[model samples]
Target: MRITALAAALVLVVASAAPASAAAADGTYEYKLLAKAKPDECFNGIGVPYPAGPPCAEGQPKVNQAYVWGLTRVGTDIWFGTGTNNNCLTTGATLGATKPVLNADYVCEYAESQMVKNDPKIPPEIGDVRPPEVWVYDSRSQRNTDLSAQIDKRSTDDKYRRDHTIGLRAAGNFKDVVLLAGPTAEGYVNVFAFDARSHRYLGSTTYTGYGNVRTFLQYDNALYLGVGVGVNGGDGGAVLRWTGSLKSPFSFDVVASLPVQAADLSAYDGRIAATSWPAEGSVNAPEKMAGVWISPLLADGLPGLTTEDAAGWKQVWNARQYEPDKVTAATYGMGGVASYGGYLWWGSMHVPMKATKVHQKVYPQDTDEAKQAQVKGTQRATSIFRGKNLGTPDQKIELVYGAVALPVYDGVTKTWSNKTTNYTPLFGKSGFDNPYNNYTWRMVVTDGKLFVGTMDWSYVVQDIVSGGSQVAAPDPVGYGGDLWMFTDPEQKATAVNTTGMGNYLNYGIRNMIVDGTGGLYLGMANPMNLRTDLTDDVPEGGWELIHLTKSCK
Candidate 1:
């Protein structure tokens, strides 16, 4: 969707994920945007569509890529704030906000990422939502405020750890569209629901699902959260639910708990959809069912789970049996979530599953060229794969659910081609941030289309962009690191379109939120101040606040 000069005054949004078109922007990094936003683009329980890009407007560089993290959207306008201070940039020098971007522009400017000081040193099993109050590039109000405090006291509690920002979501009409963020601790995930009117925290609640809730979704008036429980013998992963009821004196209830060995997810429909890795693995080994799951969400008050069910949340939906294939074993959600048109969609890291020819002999991907050759007597299953059906039917066949069961993304060709020729964006690190193909961490669908970003991949880019990958900063950088645009109509990955928007936040790109005006906003790491690691420029360096607008002129 491009905005003409006349249209730039407001904001126009379009459907993406269709067979749109565009050329890869020149490799040289130049930030671009089309500023136009719709009214109900935020928290309306509806979505706006985005056409493929290549035609968005080009703009002057916006702040030269501050290491910003966590993006939050206020109304149609976008708000971005940085995270924790490095407290040690160079030679152990402390780095915190010296005076952040209050409100920068209608065009995309300001900085975000913040280096966290008291960031919890938790296990990799949980998700952290710290560095409260994702900043709004205050426009008319001017001077950014810690709006998060209105929602979380943690804003003052320096001990609180807030990492990335997911965008603003509608909780209910009366209340503000819920903006989701995380706090670090042993087993607590904070949800600071805000009131767009008062522009303050409506009510802040934390869930003790015993697991670290990764992402969230609103459906059927319920808040579904993806909580990950370590599989190394502890509680496995599960999806916890919360009803959007402000009253009733209830803490929070576990809606439908979907359990698995290692899982991370975002809520959609009755179930929480996510990406899994290996389709099949030893009963003990984890698979990548990063596929999709639609667990039951309290069917109209079907004896909703009680505290008694907490311990038994394990019985809710054994995530291990989630997708017959169990594809996402190790990667654990490294992908995002998307629910559109009654269908759930996700992408996997394609962590190969070792299969024998016997498995291939009995069952072929219908497009197995070698199998086809065997029919012509040109090849034999014995030569192709002669062994045993390593993966059971349920696991293997279940993995192949889509317009085309066989999914193949050729990083070399930069294309996603499936068995039946269905296509989608072929995004990767080569064209992406480097080190790894920009394997998107999460995805969001607006008006029948999809958008995605890489969490860890962006960290890789930060390494190179910062000068070199010398572990200059901490590895696997912060959230919402990089952003990648794509069209996922039929599910096969297709056109790979990185916008005129460069890596505004050299940090990890986290949640993707569409605003009331259809502008795309992200919650990421606090814009970084390269005090210790890169030793780049600041005033120019450090975290930031970034906004993306697409205009076709």
Candidate 2:
């Protein structure tokens, strides 16, 4: 009766007690696949493209995984930037190598046996290799154009040409100029601009102080960028603002320096609100959890608001302040934030790595250390919170989804106070309550409805253990990217579409944009070509763009 690794994985999926839908029906909406990336072309230091043949052939260039990380719309054209995976090109690496062997997940690993044929100096690390691609899709003519070559031409240096841009992380539109956040050769996040009117690459501004700019928001006529990685000499994330014109040589000024990584930014009630990843510290490090902070509304008019003006900001919510009593250590990070339905809504980031029985052998359930691990691993439910009237001290912060109640810190009592209430679950009631679906990756408010895109890792888990078999009884909760719409404030969120536009290979919808006609544009995130085993379903294991158009009901 001893179960194998593959069989154990299958049992976990079947035990979920949920049923999978075969296909989408006619009444709701329709999905159309727009574009997909070809196999990654090996290039030299001078931008010389090498064909995928003979010596350079590594089983059809295995790392064809791509994700649309940046999306923006200008006029009738939708622009997107993609990030490709090179983890599959490693020498002797296994997926989830850091985890225990029995409970190890190889969903993120690639089985390709491709060797680095051209470059010897390129390390096997993630960011050190692979270039990102940019594309433009015209809604009028329904044409998609690959603009990677034009973006490649912007850099003439051997370092940039060899390493390639690390992919466009975030995008924003200021007037008629489109700004994209990407990495330069010097290990800094640079802002590249394109004239939407003329359709030409304007120029790029190098932010040597920051490593990666991952999020952007335009408020009041200025552009605000979120820094994920810090400068070379210093550490910690920052929120920077570009107040200069849309021309070359942009001026960037640091507004605030955060203790952890800055994840997303949004404009709420004439103020800029930011969310951050948890800081690196001990398991019970109360100050190391993620939180939401907002700047003073009047600070926008300040001519020189720098890091010295940190006192002008206020912290409304911190994840550590809301931890349950049973959970010992939780990595509470915030992902996407939006101002919708008269409230500032934000989603939690709780990724469960090792909560299965195989991991419990390393740390037993009764000990303190085991309690901490279980809290961190098993408490993967992502909670949604909203604050009404953010600027006031007595602002009502309510938990809309996932948890029944959470503990909030009381300064007067100097201890955690339980804020118990009749909390509602958005997807849990519908049987889509897996921890993998907790990543509220992105959100957009369009057509009087709030659209949410989630990163579902159930497919990755199944692919890793089951070797990508559809015949196996599927995870009851299902897998792939999930799109939900909250049209009526009184009603629960409705599932608009799922399984990444019907392509189960697409595990997440990282980027989303709304066209001029209120139609939704979804960008798929399928990295490391995890769907290689399912070649019958997806011929190329790259990312795809899916357009979801609502019919007149």
Candidate 3:
């Protein structure tokens, strides 16, 4: 009887494992890892040994962790930009106040006191600076070319340096030119242009007015991008229309002005819509709250609108409309918006510990109750929201995955919010039943289905918050980011691949592009610099370009 029962358990185990590996074997989703960053690829010159001895400075062996920050496809060439050492950058920018000890494989260079002493003019909060690189891969010829040397050859005053242009975050094609943009350390935007046909670098430009940029959309014979206006991109936001000339690539006109930083932009129902980031400092009105906003009908079906068009824009929905507490509403920002299945679909984004840090600043965790309140205030995982006929009185919005009641900490009263969220989720709780899926990093529609990619924080759960206590790490059995597919709005999304394409170090799916055929190109976000042991079962972490090809059924 014991032997029979053991055989039955073995059969169950085989059945469970079959479906998990079926995607690769069944020819439905075959992933090919095309390119990856080398372990010792350094961006900046360092160390006193100069050219001969060591390539990098002491304690900075892992300073060049890069990611495919910007990706776009023109004709037969796929163009991508790499941003180096982002975790170190985030260490200074966000986590400097309460510097937490991350995993053993990662290091935060800017947090070191000696580094700050060397350059007292710059604070530790600004982070380490490293120049980004642009590359192109020809699908037809199967050749990859690094075009970063062109920018280096034309350097005049370090405008293209890491201090001026840190990383490329957005990429899109306008007319015959492919444009890539990134924010400077001083809070300004820099753009680089390339000739799409020749694959030649057409030089770069700096826009002093815009601080940060997110996504780009080409509609009605023109290209538009969402940008933030002031320091650290917190003051306000605007949507700028490209004038479509390589000679005047930097020239753009504001089509819509927003209350906060504009994030992802999408076109739906003959209009353009955008997600937003919460403004820095304080939130006051509904417009300032992070939410989805729609523009006026597209200037008579063309891109010739004036400032009058910007004025006609309206805030269709906001965080204030859903969250009962103002604090949670202000902290929540919308992420990854896309038009799918006759509706505008978007998800909420909560920067890990952003709310917790805010509450800590106000309440100081003086008592045990205040510390509990801080934990309660930490926002839940991302929730998907979709709306039809937005910006109209009769518009209907549905919650696809979210909590019925979102808890918030009121620092003023030093108590937790008793109110509940307005909408009940149709699918399930936020993050699709996994609380670690904090950011809806990328969303794309392909093959009559909607694909949603998430940033899973399970890998870093142990080091999320600072004060010496560690959160229990998630099980390593399922540690990678997630990709979900929705065939119908009424039905729950199916898991396409939950193991980050077989690399557990890949924490997020940063970018996705449809190949027009049955293939989809994915730009993976894996920034573990010190995990360079190639002999391991799963290879080292860095940026990787993966091609997912589906077999014709």
Best by TM-score: 3
TM-score of model 3 vs. true structure: 0.87
RMSD of 1: 16.1
Q: Write the per-residue lDDT of candidate 1 for residues 288-318, one digit (tens) a residue.
A: 2333444444343454333344433322112
Candidate 2's residue-wise lDDT over 236-288, tens digit each? 56787765555653666778666655778888887878887765562355444
TM-score against truth, every candidate: 0.51, 0.78, 0.87
Model 3, range 1-553, lDDT digits (tens) per residue?
1223323432332243221221212336667788787655432222222122124443333435367888888877899887766656665676444242345445444534333445454456544445777889888887778887877777764344534566888999977888889887777888888888887777787777788888888777778899998766867999988875766656678888887888998888888899998886535687888888888887564554455677667888888887776655677878888899899999988776666656566557665444544554554688899999897788999999888986666666766765778788998878877776778877888888888888776565433332213323334455567788888877998877777777877878888888888567888887776665545454576888888788555
Give the best candidate by lDDT: 3
Ranking according to TM-score, highest score first: 3, 2, 1
lDDT by candidate, in order shown: 0.34, 0.60, 0.71
